[model samples]
Target: MLFLNELLDELQSGDYFLLYVLVSAIAISVIFAIIGTIVSMNKLVFIAGGVSHASFGGVGIGFLLAYHFGWKNFIDYSGPIYSALVFAMFVATVIYFLTRHQKRYSDAVIGAMWALGMAIGVICIERVPGLKISIESYLFGSILYVNSLDTIILCILAVILSILFFVFYKTILSMSYDEEFASIRGIPVNLLYFITLQFISIAIVLSINFIGIILVIALLTMAPYIMERFLHSMKQIVMGAIVLNLIFCICGLAIAYQFDMNTGPCIVVFAAIIFFISISAQKVLKKA
Candidate 1:
């Protein structure tokens, strides 16, 4: 009806950026859900969390370089961003390799690295001058600002990540379920671990512009974790995660539009509410 007509009119009037932002948010949520499920199954949540937060360093470096080279345009900035992501992925891999053998203090090491990465990002941003963009948006994502390019990049990354996941699904499942057994059966467990960490790093980098570094970890881990409780299998978990993510995105967008709120925080808050309800329901059912 009338609402539908108005929606169509908005689309025709080039005010569809909100829709694009929702799409990008869903893309990010799906990517993180996949990564979160994989890492959770493997009991490597801390490491993945580390990689997620550490990606801010990549953003800082990219922004600094882009500003220095007078490349404020999107196309010119893409290269440095990708290069910084490559560096972040390398750092994540090295951290993984270094801490993989440690038994008691691995989380501590990863936490230290995460803090160091954020510190470096802050320092880099402070050193850079004449940058007009708000660093907070990059650190804590303002999804309302996502443009067509961001949406396209998100879709492309999702497709590529999906293909990679499908090709190695069984092997990765095996490794996550039982790495020692997977290694015994010649499953290349170490290589799989490294690739998973790299994938997580890349996803985090891509999501920095939508969810911010501080809140990205929640979007990456919480939605999937909540859905996993209700789903009986990995496939079902993924499906449920996507559905929940879409719901949150739509509701968040509507709320942001109605209340003049920040989109990223609104989305995260919606996710938190959903998570709380899920957990409470589970508790009630268990009591019953």
Candidate 2:
């Protein structure tokens, strides 16, 4: 309680930057909650990780192109975000089509793509001459360094995702539960699935700065998974996951601040602990 008071006091006493960081953290959590629900419901949680790693290739490409050709517009911080979006969408689309037939080999394919993406990123970064870039932020995240523009972009994305969710709730629900039934009913299963992948890609790309690429998948899938253990309805799962994500993000942020630690790992570590606890509790209940 005292720590909470002190943190609130610090934020209120002109540390508006920290306030922005907190807002960004919360917004990313909400975005993750929404995307996480969709990913888990669709059973594409692994794909989320694949898409995220694939985005690193895009970041490398963006950096290379920006430095070599002097694309000033693409040299900004958001440049990698856009680049990753394109790469992620492409990867997601490819994976979607490839896995359509060989369901058994989907994991193998995704694992290959994951490794390929990171390898490409490393090669690109190494091959580029006179290009100075730190992969630390992309790998481990540095949410505290987020600026106002980043916050605004995150806010816009959150709103867009919410609106999309509201508009396509039924379509998404149907597609998630049973693709065959959705296709039978002419729900445009392929189209909707593709769109969902794109959204997941976008979510992963945007969240890279907030949670880093390596840990972003955990944020995207863990909360929803946790909620699923308790909730059966999609709506309930979404709402529950959002609340859980919010609590986790805030707690992680507060702890990071107090300890002067890295926020991304802290958040992931906290979430991992909660996930283990939830699983243990479930086991105990099942035994009873």
| TM-score of every candidate | 0.89, 0.91
In order, the Cα lDDT scores of the candidates are: 0.74, 0.84
**Clashing pairs for predicted structure model 2, backbone only:** none
Clashes of 1: 0
- Kindly list the per-residue Cα lDDT of model 1 for residues 79-153, writing each as its tens digit: 445755876797787787788777577877888878877787778878787667777776677764677887898
Runs with alpha carbons beyond 4 Å of true place in candidate 1: 1-7, 14-16, 72-84
lDDT of 2 by residue, 171-231 (tens): 8898888899999998888888778888889888987877888999898989999999988
Model 1, residue 274: displacement in angstroms?
A: 1.2
Q: What is the lDDT of candidate 1?
A: 0.74
Cα error, residue 265 of model 1, in Å, equals 1.1
